[model samples]
Target: MRTIAIGDIHGGLKALVQVLNAIEVREDDTLIFVGDYVDGWSESAQVIQFLIELSQKTNCIFIKGNHDAWCERWLRTDTVDSTWYLHGGEETMASYKDVSLADKKAHLEFLENMPFYYLDDANRLFLHAGFTSMHGVEKEAFETTLYFDRTLWEVALTLDKRIKRASAFYPKRLKHYEEIYIGHTPTTNFDSDVPMNAANVWNIDTGAAFKGKLSGIDIHTKEVFQSDHLPNLYPNEKGRNKN
Candidate 1:
């Protein structure tokens, strides 16, 4: 019954499939996806449809992401945010051109129902981005921060290795969970194409939205599984690489 924390997928359905196959997921394994399921690659709509079906046979927990929120809003209201459009939403919109209205409504409901964060029985916290509350996620004043904040990751990255959890210098937010698993900030941004751990926070987002691979990690054993780089899988697509 291993629990795996999957990183931001960003609509790379092929990469998602590759990682899941690499994991050789068993019937009892729990898959917790730390969001950004759409926007970026060419299969945004297909990816949503796949997940919707996959959840029926597997135990899965989905966390909401900023991009997902934007896509959900567009699906519900037909209003596109310019910022979202610039950041992979254009590709997401294109992916839905052939999808039926019924499927779109179902997908919109899926996105709308996802929680901003999830806490496992082991006290492990999983979220798409980060939270700003020192008292933990429940105390977060702004729901948006859970899927939009980067300060949590930034603080974790800058913490001194010498600082013990019991020490006064350790960040209060880090102490709230047995461990924190997050996506949104790609490990590739720091030059690593694999999952990176800073303090007690594990960032599994390997930048599938750009030039990196999609990644997943076993929470207990810390075993990483990755897909071929998105560029390799999607050849002609630029993904979210503006250049």
Candidate 2:
């Protein structure tokens, strides 16, 4: 059984569909999602809907993203966060404008139940974002760093790959995990549009919400699959609005 980790979708339903269709998933295979399943594009509702159906097929682990938290707050309490609205929340709202009340409620329940991280038997940790070392702290801090941290990726991107290989911060930040997977920060921000690696930390968020493609990688093999640029597939919508 293959364990595949998928990056942030950011409401790119077309890209999501294409990537899922290309992959070969089995009943025993495990699927891990790093989060940010909603917002950015105008297909947030559809993206959630597809996930609902996909859940019925195999083992699916959904990690909560900051944007997912924002979406649930609005769905359950009717309180609109102005910050969310400024950062692709408007586009997400537009997608659900026509969804049925019952369906929306179901989607809310799904989002509300999402976890912040996943630790498997292989000692690999998956989170929406990895933690930053403060005074040199381990990367995983319950769910706090799992959803909000960017230091894990930041430090990895800044240092030379050789430094990571020789002296791993995995023990400091990732605890006992052999490897870690994360999303949240787009790969485009690093001026690349592919999955990146630093020591035992792997970043698969290829920025499908921006000018990059949706990415999926086999956790064990590092085999990659990608879709077209999000804007190319979604011509009418601006993938993300700068806040």
Candidate 3:
């Protein structure tokens, strides 16, 4: 059975479907989504509903993302955060305009129950963003950092390729996992539209929220599956690029 690490979706349900179809998902394959399931494109609510149903037919692990946390709060309290509203939450709110209160409550529960990070039996770590603790995720002092931090990726990128894991200069955080898979920081930021690896960390977020494609990678083989660019799929939408 193959385990696939899917990148940040950001409400592109069409892109999500295309990527899954590209992967040709089997009954035994496990799909681990790194998160940001909502807030960006026009299908935020539909993406959540699709994921809820997908999990029932196959094994899936969903990690909570910062955008998702903001959406969840709005769903539960009927109040919007200005920052969130500016960053694609407005689109997310619009997507749920026709959703029933009971369906919203169920979606809220799904978001509320997601784990911040997941560790597989192979010691691979999957998280929406990054963690700050040198001792690993369990020792993280602030839960918010798990989905909001970028320092982890920054540090990984700066590490010298010559530095061996056994060397004194190796970051303790990177040493904690056999391999780490993360989303949140888009690979497009580095001028690439595909997944990028820094040190032992694999960043799968291909920036589907903006102009990039949704991506998924096989953890063991490192085979990548991508959907058509979001802009191509939704011609009239600006997505989060409007921000």
TM-score of each: 0.99, 0.91, 0.99
Q: Write the per-residue lDDT of candidate 1 for residues 1-243, one digit (tens) a residue.
A: 899999999989999999999999999999999999999999999999999999999999999999999999999999999999999999999999999999999999999999999999989999989988899999999999999999999999999999999999999989999999999999999999999999999999999999999999999999999999999999999999986
Regions of model 3 farther than 4 Å from truth:
none
- Compared to the true structure, candidate 1 yields what TM-score? 0.99
Please report, as a residue range, the 10-residue window in candidate 2 with the lowest summed lDDT.
133-142
lDDT tens digits by residue: candidate 3, 1-243: 999999999999999999999999999999999989999999999999999999999999999999999999999998999999999999999999999999999999999999999999989999989998899999999999999999889999999999999998999999999999999999999999999999999999999999999999999999999999999999999999994
Clash-forming residue pairs, model 1? none
* Residue 102 displacement in candidate 3 (angstroms): 1.3
Over 23-99, each residue of candidate 2 has an lDDT whose tens digit, in order, gives 76778988899999998988999999999999998799999998999999999988889998888889988898999
Query: Considering summed lDDT, which 10 consecutive residues are worst modelled in model 1?
Result: 234-243
Error of 2 at 94 (Å): 0.9
Candidate 2 matches the true fold with a TM-score of 0.91
Alpha-carbon error at 66 in model 2, in Å? 0.7
